[model samples]
Target: MASTQQSRILRVGLLQDGRILEERHLRRPGDLTVGRDAKSTLVLPLSEDLPARFTVFEYRANQYNLVFSAGMKGRVHLGSSDVDFEALRADGMAMQRGHQYVLPLQESARGLVELDGDLSLFFQFVPPPPAAEKPQLPPDLRGGLWRTMDRVFFGILAASLLLHFSGAAIIIASEPPPEPELSLDELPDRFARVLIPPKPEEPKPRAAETAQAAAATEEKPQSNDAQDKPAEATRPANAQEAAARRAEVVKKVEGKGLLKILGSSGSGGGGAFADVLGGSTGGGEIAAALAGAGGVGIATEASVGATGPRGGGTGNVAGIGELGTSGAGKVDLGSSKKEVEVSGRVTSSTPEVESSDVDREALARYVKVRLKAIQNCYEKELKRNPSLKGKVMVRFSILPSGRTGDIEIEENTLGNDAVGSCIRTVIRSWVFPFKPDDEVPVAYPFVFSPAG
Candidate 1:
């Protein structure tokens, strides 16, 4: 019975201020310690009065012993009797040397040991807990892949793989042979025409016709009437015929109401108007006088005839010659040449950093790389006003995530609101390569000018 009790395990429990903290089962021949130290078997809350470590229970000579250190207060229960540490020391039942007392503990002994009146340790011998059973799957459910997988599914998968490989092999082996390559020289004419077409032949000039055309162009300045009129009406054989034609045209003009109308106005107004009309007897002379007076003129030359009155004149003059036979000539109203268009250039200067954590060189490099995008903002506005050229200073902050925020135009000598707004929008999209510990303030300036 003594040997059987020695074989049983000792159960030790720790209490803090009378509240149970933890319990542990110790086998025979094993020692137990309790203290605030981490290596102790039973650890307790740290206290100035408590020692770093103290052996509370010891197993020796096939028997368990209880140890009481100095300042420790407790009672030991043996069977139906109780013995205090002081009583044990007085009766010499417990061995005492210096500041510690040892009492042999029986299998049925159980008691509480207090440390500084704050911590208590309970100890006793008890049966050990039952051994845990090993986990296992049921016999019907346990097996390898053959028993677990569907046999029909596995067979179908194998058949499908075999058919796929067989079809691929048949198609590859039965493919048609390759055609022979042909040289460019041996190719058909149709292909030759498609690949290398013949150059078109330029028309050759006729020397006689060209010479006559050059002489005609040089002799007479090109006129719209000359181009529109019949060859016979455009050129007369001799001066006599030309003079005869001019007299005929004058006679025809006088036959109309033009002279009578002018004479009637002159007769009423008198002055130079009457004298000029009254003195002009011949229609040719009158037409010349009207021409010199900045009025309607009749051409005596065979190529052109009478024309409409100059300035603002009211009268329907009949027998005014053919449609393309009369006109002073073509007058240049304005130039057809285009005005030169100019573009403006946009550039940025080095950025000014106002942060201790952000790297100046890195910030400048990032700004330089994205400077083109910023410049694009100004250049878009610069296109509208070529003279748009000035400095724009932008203020912004780099967040901890390296993204820009609070972007605003601090100074815009450029004086264009659209440009400033565009710059702000562009800067807001910029993200630096580095993340800052805190937000960093930055100022950047840009200059714009028309490209020379």
Candidate 2:
């Protein structure tokens, strides 16, 4: 399981529990030196030791090419007697920083090996056990051409590296002062306020008050004249009303009990009736009433005419006297049509919405189920690393109908990728309880991080 660039020592029990963790293999350079901080020589329990001495080369895609010596053959380094490595792993907990890798068994053989970390090579996977059958190749591709390029290619590579190193040294020596470090303290304060002029105070309003006072003074004289004119008009209105009342009294005396009136003639409901109010009399009734009458009253009009010889005295004394005599007059009657009026009342109504339309209890139950589903995933990570702490904010889609939709990364948020990756992988596998409408995905950004 271990190799060197020059030689290899295939040790048994390199990965005793079928796992090699890089974190478990890390050690301070000082810790590697003997005797200063050494632990007591206590035998380890049923656990393989981490590699005490090793050289690590990182390869792409989560692979490592490790090499180490077999000087302590058949004896592996002791695990930290203080810790339980198995429980930490089983719970998905991270080991300590100094604990990177584990080696279960070591082989004593020292030779050149091209062993793979994976199935085939570094950045590749190796089989758990060797293949029993040998592989065959086609005859045409089995030529010696692949072997010839190794030496020439390596020689050219070495020469180019040497030239590059010489050029880099020359550039470094020629430079003078080091560039200034980037700091916010060195930059100007962009948020500083700029200078501005003070605003002028508003003017007082004495002039407007003076103008209003002068206008009020001018209106006083005009109001006095208007009052004096109304006093003069009151006397004439009193005289005209008295004359009309006398005529109304005479008419009431003549028509008292002979005719009944519909309404009073005065404005306050007590004056005599002004219009003719009796119905037409029948001929037979009027004749019978006249038979009892001893005398009948008759009216007559006489015509006066003057002949030329009859010595007509100048009866027309003046032009003004004849004008006052009676003459035929034209008259007008008004407003014959009746007026029509419309009337109705107004009322209001409300919309058909109600609060009980949505089922609140069902919604609350669904929310609880979702929260529990998410909490279960967090417990898995905590069990693995009790010391692990972080908050991860993930922006993923929940469909309008409540199904899981797109899963995406929410950038610029708190999270540990080691923990986040596992959580995300497991959450995408869950099934939701409801179907969403419109299939429109809504993003929920959930966060998890260290409590501190």
Candidate 3:
């Protein structure tokens, strides 16, 4: 529906040479005239076929009365239909707001106004809305006596509430504090005894056997040179010599198969003592074996002790100082390399593909739907002056998410900004079906003509 406010004013929208010339407004109810004369209300450019005055409009009784001058030769129209003056005379045809009327002159002097040039007119009317009535009330509420009584009763009730709360505060402030349930003097004897601490007991003396062992080590006889040098003097010498000697012994024993010797010596194997003694009663070799196993320089003492003791220095010794296990003397390797084997299988996969095509027919259908929403913007203006015609080219991009953006007018020749902007806004809101991983660009053209 057309707006009622549009009916309140008469608008003359003019177009000359395919461009907008001017727009005129008439808000008052009076006579309007258009012609070539200086005395006319609206003077046009010079033309011989046009009389001194060509047209007249009278606004009376909220209706416009239109008529042509006596000598004018051209025809006037509401859209494409010819005006029926006879029917207008019979009942006075009414002109509605938002409707367009056109006039084409046959003669022109200024090339600006051609013989087929059009003078277009559109109207806007706004009738005032009706007024509303005031509401009525009872006479009792309006009188002064009841109003005074209402105020006095409300004041009395407020004062009573204040007094009642003030009395409650006074009663709460006058109450006494609570008494204790028990006193500290009533506690029992066990609680008092916890304050005292008990005395500690003395430690027992050491055993006599342990005291004898300590004294024997302390009283052992020492040589004159050893007693003078002190125990700290022997530490460095022992460390260097022990490390070198132990390494030499380990190399010799490992090359001669110490594990095989130990195993055969304990078993009933032939030549077990032959391997240890090398099939000869060699005292020097026996002395060397005793010194290596004991980790001490007592080879001569061991030979003398063996000659006296139960044929025993070469016999199986259950415990040899630190030789409890074979692995105990093995060299440490910090980090060792390890080899791991792993095997795996791989499988191939195929993904689905989608079609990507620029369908002009599909795009045309979408543009047809969009055109219905914006064509009226140009139609209402184009209907008045039929000569104005041009094209609007809009460039836009469709995002992967199926939304339109970056809309811009590449070209516009519609002669007015409103028509171009209306079409641009509709183009920016267009949505197409989503294309996977693709962005589409579009440059669409729209043409407008009086005939269209």
Per-residue lDDT tens digits for candidate 2, residues 1-452, read 32321132222222213443211221111111111122511112222333232332223222232322222121112242222334334443322324343222212311121222321111112223433587667777666766656888888999999999999999898968788886755655553222334577998779989899999999999999999998887553576796666556545754545333323354423332322211211212222223344753331222122321124354432233334657878675655775433221111122111233323455344444565455545555555544444444444544545555666555423244554565467557755554444443323334443233
The residue-by-residue lDDT of candidate 1 on 1-452, one tens digit each, is 46766567888888877778898877546889977899999888878878899898877777778888646679989779988888888899989868788898877888988876667888877887776698888988778889989999999999999999999999999968899899988899999999898999998899999999999998676575677677756687899988788778866776467565554434334533355544333323554655445545554433122433333354554444534655588888777786566566777777888877787788877778777776777668776877788999989999999799798889999889998898888888887877878888999888888786
Query: By how many angstroms RMSD does model 1 differ from the true structure?
Result: 20.1
List per-candidate RMSD values in Å. 20.1, 34.6, 32.1
| TM-score of candidate 3 against the unseen true structure | 0.21
* Candidate closest to the true structure, highest lDDT: 1
lDDT of 3 by residue, 34-131 (tens): 66788866676676765576445555545454544322223334444544433333343433323322222111101111222464332223343333
TM-score of each: 0.34, 0.17, 0.21
Worst 10 contiguous positions by lDDT, candidate 2: 27-36
Q: What lDDT is obtained when candidate 2 is compared to the true structure?
A: 0.39
Worst 10 residues of 3 by lDDT: 104-113
